[model samples]
Structures are given as structure tokens and as C-alpha cells.
Target: MDNETTTTYRKIIHIDMDAFYASVEQRDNPELRGKPLVVGGPPEGRGGVVATASYEARKFGIRSAMPSKKALQLCPHALFVRPRFAVYKEVSQKIREIFSRYTDLIEPLSLDEAYLDVTDDKLNVGSAIEIAKQIKQAIKDELQLTASAGVSVNKFVAKIASDINKPDGLKFIGPSAIEAFMEQLPVEKFHGVGKVTADKMKKMGLHTGADLKKLTQDELTGRFGKVGKFYYQIVRGVDERAVQPHRETKSMGAEDTFAYDLTTVEEMNDELDKIAQAVYNRLLKYNLKGRTITLKIKYHDFRQITRNQSFPFPVGDLETIGNTAKQLLLASGIDDKRIRLLGISLSNFGEAAVKVKGDEVSEQLKLF
Candidate 1:
């Protein structure tokens, strides 16, 4: 590669906190240390979801988004604690402060993870791997928490590398090794490939990056829509997307999976009211208004669907949100159906209908 080509490779590092919520609980409570701990809602009543599980609890196959009831069943002796978002946010801010010391070009994916572009670092730390080590050490020394870091020439590879080792680990993948690393990766291991997509790929005999690379871009796009183009480039280690520091808010929303299926319209409407309040609170927090409202429903059988309504003017009131969602639900013919989950979201923020950075509000609040 020419000098210009070589210089185009940006040095990026992805940092992910180790089992953030559960780790925080364990750190603050001496009795919780070294024991199987879960941070989320209580497993009693309808049974809430697990927000995160301590490394000790993970040995029993506990994970985030699993039902707290199931987690308990996996490890009956496991301890459950409700999530403390206020404390987690405070610690997240401190973690970002540590990142700011090295580079201003930091893109946080969530409270627990972020990507930092340090090709021209403020501290003149020429080696990306060294910067990652310093940042990890600082987080451990200052906060008494551990983090995993992945250092690479681009965001995609770096993000994947960060998870290769977990609970206080670091992995480095240079430009020269990115291709081979990607080729060896399972389709499920690709950052954005979810279970459904992974199963689809497997059915088609495309199980790894190398398998995916066998198809042309046209063939992949024809099979997987526009995202296939992304897969095509990513598998070849050609992610040119920058580490965007200021990503716009494309949409904001909240969702809840009930403890039991709601069979009555009144119950569903009441649930919508609570969910709308959550979405409205978030809109007010961000000072945003949207012209579109979307309602997502998942039935007791795990089948899902969505309905949306759009208006010419933006709205942010609780009444509009709640009522509109109810209207959408009613129109969707919820009769004789057991509803397990409901969600409300607002979007089309005038000129700010752009890509979002960090986690979407719906994703952040999905377990609520």
C-alpha cells in the first residue's frame, strides 16, 4: 500500500465495562463479592428480566435480557438486586472522563461500552495498544472496576476484538491481521448479526466470514437487503466509517415485557399509559419532539408486529403518545390475542432524522 493508503487506517479502540451493573453491585457490597450476583428486577411476582449478571453468575448461563426467573432457575442460590441506574450513570461519566484524557474522538455505544479514535491522540500516545493498556489500568486503579479493550485499525474489528476476551481483557488486531481474523469469525460473532440472521445464514451454509465472502456483493444484497452490502465490505475488513462523536437522535422510545400476558383491553391500555410516560420522560430529558409514533407488540407465542401513525406536526405530550398507541393497538385487532410485550416510540424529528449514536432509547429500555 502507498503512504496515503497506509495513513488512511485509523487507530481505534473499543472499551467495554465488565458486567457493568452487576460488577458495580458487587464492588459496593462486600458480602456480594465472589458470589453469583444478578442486577435487575426481583425474580418474584411476574418475574423481571436480568439487566446484567456477575461473572460468577455467568458460569450458570445467566445473561442480560434473560428472565430473572430463568436466571434463578439456572442458579437457585444466585442473589438478585435491582438495577441502580443513577449510580451506573455516575460511574459511566467517570469512565468517559478517563477516555477524554487520551482522545476527544470518542463514540459511546452505551453506558458500558465506547469506541475511541486515537490516531492523533491528545496525549501523543503513538501506540494504540499502549493507550488501551493505560486506559484499562486507569479505570482499574481509579474506579476499582475492570474493562476490556480491543485495539485495531477500524471500528468494526476493534469492537469485535473487545469481546473476544471478557471481564478485564484486551485484544489487539492490526491491519495486517484483520482479514484473517474476520474470516475465522463465526457469522454470529459479527457485531450486528442477531440470532435470526445468524440462523438464516447458517441455513444457507454461510457460517463464517470466509463463507460470506464467497458470494459477490450483488448476491449478498439480493439475499439480505442493503445490510448485505455492509456485510460484504465488513467481511473484507474495509470499514471506512469514521468514529462519529456527535450522532443525532433519530428516535427515542421505551418498551416493556409484562410479567403475564394481558387479555383485556383495559390492561393493555394501562400498560401503554405507563410505557408512554417513560417515553415522554425521555423526550423531555432530551428536549425532543417527533411527528411519528410507533407501537410494537409481541404476542405470548413470541410473534411480533408493529403499527405506526404520523402527523404533520411534532407532538410530545403524554396523552397523544398513550392514546395514539392505544388506537394503534386497537386497530391492530388485539382481540382474542394474548399480548406479552408493548412498546412506544417517537421519531421523524424534523431535520434530525439521522443515524443515532449509542444505544437507541427502545433498546436501552426494552427490558422495562
Candidate 2:
């Protein structure tokens, strides 16, 4: 299609809350205001991983998925609270209602973020940027919260633009500006370019989109396979993927890479208990249960194995997740092994809703 025809066909907006879980906690509890706050599990003893770190905590080098033990070391005075996914889900639904005022094509990425297509808005508003401003204001006025919005003609540019400014920021990358915006963006900042891929690109003198654009699709695919093909199109601002509102959540899981390895079974079980609790909370939040419980173990040498047991009936309770994982660990024989990571997940949503099936292992991505 022609460029003008393409521009009018899609106009996507990505709305991301500022440290969502932590922000909600701070908003509800005034005592947490202006202090470093982490919402996940307790930060004491064997501890847990951070689900979300407040901007204040982030200043101290604390981040989501980091060990709660390490978060305490970075900011000992930081406040730690277990996540209340139920409350966060409530807030998510409220924000979504606000989004419905502008568009029905809304795809939620998490409880904290969503992608909205406002190309043909319900309100008949022609300006995507204005619609974004209105949505952000509605969130602030109605929910007493702030969010960042990125407006562009497609999902990729809009997702990246939303992060340009954060914690109450809005950026619009129009059709003309997309080229310059992508060219200067750091390779690491590209959505799918993980650290491993970025390191390889840097070693090959490709640090920015401009540097990446020098390679042909065949050359890129030769270097990075499937992901390389993605890079070739993304660098040219050619992401045509539609805003899929009903993206299936194939699996729900929580994993942590620790500061130290567990040399004994006791230590490993403690970590597993924390991870199971996290997984259980997420299950409740999504209102999902699965028949499969997978226990993931990574050793100090980076070797990993997953052992999952399926049940006739789906389970999402805390006890089942924790106890089953511990049992699997025991059967696997963990004697004298140095364990560096532990995670638990529920998969095979098993008729929860909408028939979504998928599995994913996520890497830490920076939020603006």
C-alpha cells in the first residue's frame, strides 16, 4: 500500500502506567509517598523477587525481578509489601473503562500496560495525540494516577515512543518523524533486541538503528535468524502488525536469578516457596488455573531443567503450587548442586476464557 494509505490505516497508542503496582500501593497508602517502595514479597530472610519497584527505589539501582534481598541492600530503608494483584486488577479494569471512551480495540499487555488503536475512534476524534492526552487525564482525575502515552501509526513505534518520557509523559511520533526516531534509537532500546542480541550487534559495530539499516534482510537473517528478519523491517519503521487485543497468555510464571546459589535443599525450597506465592497471586489476578505446574531450575553453571506434572484438575492454590514444586525438586535429586535460579509457572489455561494458549520466558526490559 502507499505511504499515505498506510498512515491512515493504523494509529496506535501505547499506555503504560508509572511503576504501576508500586504506584497503586503508594496512592492507597500515603505513608509510602516519596519513599523507595517495592511491591512483591517480603525483603527479609530468603526473601522474594520484586514485582515492581517505585521510581524512588529505582534510583537506588533496585528493579523488578531483582532479588528482594538485593533490593534491601541497595536501599535498606525501602518499604517492601507483598503484591495485591486483586486490587491492581480492579484498577486495571477501571482504566480500561476509560479507554473504552475512545476506542474498543484495546490490547492489554499486563495489568499495568495496554495498546489501543484509535484510528477510527468512537468519539470521532481525529487527532490521536489529543485522544492520548485525554486518556492520560482521565486516568489521573478518575483513578488518581499518572501514565505515559506514546502515539504513532503502528504498534512498534507507538510502544517505543511511550517510553521516551515516563512517569507522566506523552510522546507522539508522527509519520514523518518515525524515520529519524528509529534511526537514532539504541539497539538495546528496541523491543525485541535482548541483551544477548545487543551485545552481538555492538561487537559487530551496530549500536543504533541507523547502523542496523546498513545490512540487507538476507545479511541480517544470516547473522540472527528469525529475530534478524524482524530487525530489518523494524529499522525501516515497517511494523505492520495489527493491535491484537485478544493476545493469548499461553503461560503465567515467575522466575528469579539470585545473587548467590543455593547449596542446600532447604535454601532452594525457601526460594521456591516465594516463587510459588508469586505465581499463585498472578493466577488469581488473571482468574486462571492450569493443569500443568512446571518447576524450573538453573544451576550455578547455567545448566537448566524443567520438570512439570499435569493433573486431571487445574489448580491455582498457593499450597498446591508450593508443595508440588518442592516435591518435584526432591525427586530430581538436588544434593550438592549449586542452584542459581528458581521459578514456578501455571500453563494450559484449560478453558479459562477466549481459548488463549502460549508459553513465554521473558527477559528484563527497561522501562524508559
lDDT (10s digit) by residue, model 1, range 1-368? 65554356789999999999888898899899999999887788778889999999999999998989999999999999977877888898899999999998989888889999999999997999999999999999999999999999889999999998887999999988989999999999999999999999999999999999999999999999999999999999999989988778878888888778899999999989999998999887777889999999999898999999999999999999999999999999987999989999999998635444443343445464
RMSD of 2: 5.3
Most lDDT-accurate candidate: 1
Clash number for each model: 0, 1
- Candidate 1 stretches with Cα past 4 Å from truth are 1-6, 203-205, 222-225, 262-270, 299-303, 326-338, 352-364
TM-score of each: 0.87, 0.78
The residue-by-residue lDDT of candidate 2 on 32-134, one tens digit each, is 9999999876765556778889999999999888878899999989999887766887898898899889987888777778899999999999989999999
The most accurate candidate by TM-score is 1
Of candidate 1, the 10-residue stretch with the lowest lDDT total is 355-364
- Ten contiguous residues minimizing lDDT sum, candidate 2: 359-368
lDDT of 2 at 128: 91
Clashes of 1: 0
